[model samples]
Target: MTAPIALHGSNISYFTGKLENYFRVKGLDYTLHAMKFPGDGKRIERELGVYQMPVLQLADGRWMTDSTKIIQWFETEQPTPALIPANPAVAFICYLLEDYADEWLWRPAMHYRWYYDEGAHFAGRHLADEHLGSLPVPGALKRAFMRHRQRSGYTRGDGITADAVAGVEAIFLRLLEQLETIFRSRPFLLGERPTLADIGFSGPFFRHFALDPVPLEVIRQRAPAVLEWVARLWNTRASDCTGSEPDSVPTDLGPLLEAIGNEYLPYLNANVAAVAAGKKRFDADIGGVGYRGARYSRYRVWCLAELRRQFEVLPEAARADVQALLQQHGCWEPLWQEKLLPLLPGQDEGLPFRASTKMVGANETV
Candidate 1:
């Protein structure tokens, strides 16, 4: 037997939980270990050229980063009981949903986790004990530092000001309702079986939405079916599933696509504009919410570029179908809104092995 993969990251981290869910469902042998801060961060930077969660260390001593790229690499190595659908159009949709879940939902997920006192306190204490226990600082100080750092970098500092709080929370609530409707009828996002779409969403749901106190209560009270999906996905193993792969995207998923069209793509366009203007922060009114001083991300600029690249690689027929679908939901215009994406040289070219930029700030120690 081969040595178990060494998965290093915080137990409660969003991306770590996402990779853990994928590894569990794929039946890959792995062991989870807390990424000791300061030390681990420096080491990971040396190995992967970036400090990020859920870095996978192979038996041969190879290190991997970026949960999305890591999963894609694994899927290529093991295609049976596929996590990504086989059909081209369906697979494209899965990729789209995955990207939406990764970049768009992150705002609300971060807001819910760090904006509320209930969530901040819970996560702060857990992270303090899990990732910072070896430190000589007092536990209370560690917890306090965690809370302050998270709020500073992720929630308030990122753009969830008091005025934007309700709007951010509404995003999560609306998501729960949409997902509840979908999960009420099917066991997975695409169909009766799990797919890349489910795995992508697992990033937010498995760790933040389902684990955070305030959002967990809201989920229990408003969208119990979604709550059940959180547990069901964690318990599911893809090798055991006998369900047929979905040949097409479901109609119920139109709402989610519509949300991406209306809310997410426009935001990406705004970010693209911000990056082009060489601004570190820019304010934009997204989904009727006026956000001031929202930090711009070059990484998200690459996300939009990557989405277009995926579309470009699809077959002719699949591209036609995808074009219609995206157009139907108002995604086509903004998706191609930036005629020339301001991509930095070699940006994101070394994914899974190296990183040119991070999803957010790179100074997150704990």
Candidate 2:
């Protein structure tokens, strides 16, 4: 038989852990290859056009980057033990929550990995040793540089300032509490089986928050059940249980959704504005702390666009229910209000987009 598909990423990566654990849960046969970073031809920038980890190379040699997209690819191939729900409302909620976990949770994950002296040192050592091992650079030099680079990047990237510590900490603690509450009853975020929602949350929880030495201790102390779920995601198989039910989003998931709306939406709004304004970065206040994001992100904009598109196609009753739930959790306005507009005509508009009005315009296209 052909070898299982290859996941080119390191264990220390957030999305890597997300997809790695997901493949196991889905019962897909896959092999893990440590991704080489910086000047390595094995997974170079020209191939991916970006420096990112956790790309899945398919059997025919096509590379699939972006964690959410990869999960969708699996959905098409498997379809049983489905990662997304059948109910339009629940499925759409999974899309938004998955987007939340994929994009927004990166802040806390990065903060934990790089903000502290111990965590930074620990992560830097692992990153350099793993990804930079075969490079011409000296081990000590690369390790120190990696340490400084990641910490500085995270600090500036996520607005991890001294004053921002409390807010970030609050998010981490609340997430742990909510996961514990939900997992105490159900096996996964959505219901009886693992879904996109579980994989989404597992991204940060498995690698950074739960696995990192510093945050792992915090998790163990405050919410050990969260850790158990992470382990379960890594160890369980699709056949282990049936899956999430149709037409339902668990009541316990409300806190998780509320946190997503409370925290992630604001940052997403700023990024959307930045994409529209043709600026590389935008300012926003998250957790009451001011931050200037490093740059605009097209993928995240696409995530919002995809959610809106999915919501638009749902049946009327389902749409209304989903919108109401979003409103209750504080997620409706931004997504519903500012739609992703068309690409700039005759060019790859390097910029992201938001519709000028409610309707898709003559210039509009996904």
Candidate 3:
């Protein structure tokens, strides 16, 4: 008998949307358990050793965290209808692009949802109040819940300001322009078929840009073709494509990863920093990478180190290709290295990539 696949997530979550798209694209059999804000869902997630949702509770009882990890797992467990391309170079590029969409694109998406949209702003607060009502707390609990939500970096409710909203809008428009250039010639980001890049990007494009009324209007007005592509990707069913999986790095794939690490990754990081720091406004030009106006504390260092480690593990030839790509993309210089500090010892070293081997006797509380 097959093990059960359960997903714990909320509908309002972009990450959850990404996971759901993976399930649909992979034709995986699963159940989605909707969770209320500030609920026991996080406690269940902690017990299972997963940090965040859309967690995949595997049949053997092991849990998987992060949408990217879960999608990779699906590629291994069900090889048909491959989300990744057969060519290593193309596949690596697709993965890197997907990472950009998932990580950097999030800043603008969050800013819009929590800060710009009045309906979402109040609704989120109300949702928090309802979730906290389940507890036996006394007076001023609602205010406390609001404060807690503000502090939790995961919440989309607190990181809003007029400047932030403008930044998000700028990022969105820039991404659309880049995507239009990429997709105008090809149906997918790669060439012919939908790759992991398409699936990965579909989540944000669907939820924040395509669905959100304000951003959607902006996308429609500025880049209708990009919006069209978003629709095309979402409407696709897994059964429509010829399925095949790329499990190992192909020799030719080195250049792609190298390009991503050297050029795209650095660009992305810098762009994010600009937004967080308010050094640069979030516009089409600023959409490359880096969180502006945001601090590069422990969490930022940990994430960057993990990414570097993943890049380091690539074949030496692949590393060279990445270096070359970075140079080509004009990303050879280190711009934000001064602001970044090293992570504390014993911090969580969670890379976005993982192997498919299933461990027996893993916990599954959530």
Tens-place lDDT per residue, model 1, 236-282, is 99999999999988989898998999899998999889889988878
| Model 2 per-residue lDDT tens digits across residues 208-253 | 8987778899988888778888888888887777554756877787
How does each model score on TM-score?
Answer: 0.97, 0.88, 0.70
Candidate 2 overall lDDT versus native: 0.73
Cα displacement (angstroms), candidate 1, residue 91, comes to 0.7
lDDT of 3 by residue, 1-366 (tens): 245578776555677777777676666667877655455565644554434556666777766676766677678767777786655545655666677667656666655555444525553555455455565666366644554444344222223334445555655665677777666766666655677888878777776667666777777787777888877776666578653344433333334334444544564465445434544233222333333334223333344554555556667777676556545554434323435534444445342322111210011111
Show the lowest summed lDDT stretch of 10 residues, model 2.
Answer: 357-366
TM-score of 1: 0.97
RMSD of model 1, in Å? 1.6
Report how far off residue 153 is in candidate 3 (Å): 4.8
C-alpha RMSD of each candidate structure in angstroms: 1.6, 5.6, 7.6
Name the lDDT value of residue 186 in candidate 3: 60
Candidate No. with top TM-score: 1
Please identify which of the two predictions, 2 or 3, would achieve the higher TM-score against the true structure: 2
Ranking by TM-score: 1, 2, 3
